[model samples]
Target: MNRIFATSICVILATSAAAAEVELSFYGGVQSAPSSDVSIRDDDSIPDGDFSIAWEGRSLEAPPYYGIRATKWRSPEFGYGLDFTHNKVYPENDELPAGYDVLEFTDGLNTLTVNAYRRWSSAFGEVSPYIGGGVGVSVPYVEVANSDSETFSYQLTGPAATWIAGASYPINDQWSVFGEYKGTFSSNTADLDTGGTLETDIVTNAVNLGLSFNF
Candidate 1:
């Protein structure tokens, strides 16, 4: 199986006869945290401890996202690339436990994704309007504050499906900039491993601006 996959890639590189120059891009920008569903179990009851979400999660601020992408244009209108980007959001508010009025909370969700995308671009004078999409998995990290004032933590290790869309313009032969939106959908909201069961789907949508180099 590994040999067959390797051979397929080799065939692609070899048959890239009509390929344009490969493009390497780096970008950074802000992402609006998507609305998520969250819940925390206050007790331990095995596989049936009321596995349900009770809170809707939202971001108090826009988090930052950044990444690098390498694309191979097989032709002027068609191309494929490997894209890796990061998008994250922090917990803004928490429903306090019964007696405590404050949780002194400090935690957030961080997602890093590696994706494969197909893109189509059209040229109008010096500007190129393009649309593309990718399917990938997002690796999420849930950080729960553990301190004297805080008393819980969590560890998440899994990949969730992700998607993206965007467009870009060429400033010159070697330079270009782009604006794109990315969405990362997760399946962790149903069951999260934490001090308590912290249930929240870490979905995100980010608008990014980046620079590209053709080499």
Candidate 2:
């Protein structure tokens, strides 16, 4: 029994050391001002509820986001790799002026992204800095209702692009804290059943902080 326990401890330590080189991180944090302007008309406007507010609004809710990354240290100075994430934009409600009975302007944007980057580190515990870009497809799901009419539903999806730059600080071999600033650019054009088209351009900026595991 003592021999087995000793072997297990050795294995665990070995795994932790290995992780210091190749890392996999999982994090969830809050990002604000990560939205665009919604123009319901010429005079009325509202801010978009991006991934930072997907689940709910007006509370102490920390928007959740998860991603996976792989890194290969080239020297003590540089490294590169790939990453992916699924993010959401919350839904909002707005009422049109009198004579118009639109119940909700509830629309959301969900996207998937792929990115590549390079890292730069210095002696102060290592700063893995990187910059890379990616493409995503934005899908918008919308629902609308009126007093005397049945509810209407529809969806729209379009392509998008993004650029990111950030750094990570190693607290230890297998654990670290990181922050990233990402910018997303996209557009949407849809024809309303009521006649005419709804067109929009979207821009989002976000910052994230959380735990990262090396290896």
Candidate 3:
């Protein structure tokens, strides 16, 4: 009877310790303050009486985003993670007007990014501060409702970069919450065969609210 009681107590302690071995976390909210800027070109040379012309500028606003991250600690202070995120921004108008030309544009900005990052925990309660960057791809779609006489469309997919800084806190043994600010950068260029080519650059600034899990 004594041996049986000792074994039962040992099993309970082992189970409790094992439960702390792994942690899962989740978080969600809103990301405010988003800004974007782009440059567009139709030609570089004058056709008849005109000269070279181009338009480029920047804009700022508050934008929102959501994401999820899973981290598994190989040790206490350091761990590896997988992160996924989504962002959506709409254009103010379907048509963009220039000095002498008008462009019919449809659709906004939509993207999903995935990357791997390293996490670090500090003295703050169950919370930790982390900084990491990864490379991914950006897919942007645009529709031209009226291209002179015919409608035209194209897609942009290329290399992009993601950098984040945020804090995360544990709610329990298996769950936690996180918030971060992320920036994405990319560009696209094309040749039209007529005169000069067209080049478009897009930059997205976003605030991210989401959750983190450890196992």
Q: Which number leads on TM-score?
A: 1
Best by lDDT: 1
Which residue pairs show backbone clashes in model 2? 19-214, 19-215, 22-215, 23-215
lDDT of 2 by residue, 1-215 (tens): 22322333354345445544655555444432233443332111221121211122211233244344445455565544434333434433332433334422233333344444566675444676766677755544433223433234434446767677878888987798888876666565544444334455556556666577666
For residue 200, what is the lDDT in candidate 3?
A: 47
Q: Against the true structure, what is every candidate's RMSD?
A: 8.0, 11.3, 14.0
lDDT of 1 by residue, 1-215 (tens): 12322433454444344456777777777665544554555443212232222232233333334566667876777677655555545434454334333222123333433445555454466556665655544334444333222333333434566666777787877788888876666555323333355455555676678898876
Q: For candidate 2, which ten residues in a row score worst on lDDT?
A: 42-51
Candidate 3 minimal-lDDT segment of 10 residues: 46-55
TM-scores, all candidates, are 0.62, 0.55, 0.56
Model 2 alpha-carbon drift over 4 Å, by segment: 1-23, 32-108, 123-125, 143-156, 189-198
The ten-residue window of minimal lDDT in model 1 covers: 45-54
* Runs of candidate 1 exceeding 4 Å displacement: 1-20, 41-64, 93-120, 146-156, 189-197
How does model 2 score by TM-score?
A: 0.55
Ranking by TM-score: 1, 3, 2
Our tally of clashes for model 1 stands at: 0
Q: Taking the tens digit of each residue's C-alpha lDDT, what string does model 3 give over 109-189?
A: 333344445566666756788776766554443332223322233344456666777877777765677777776565544
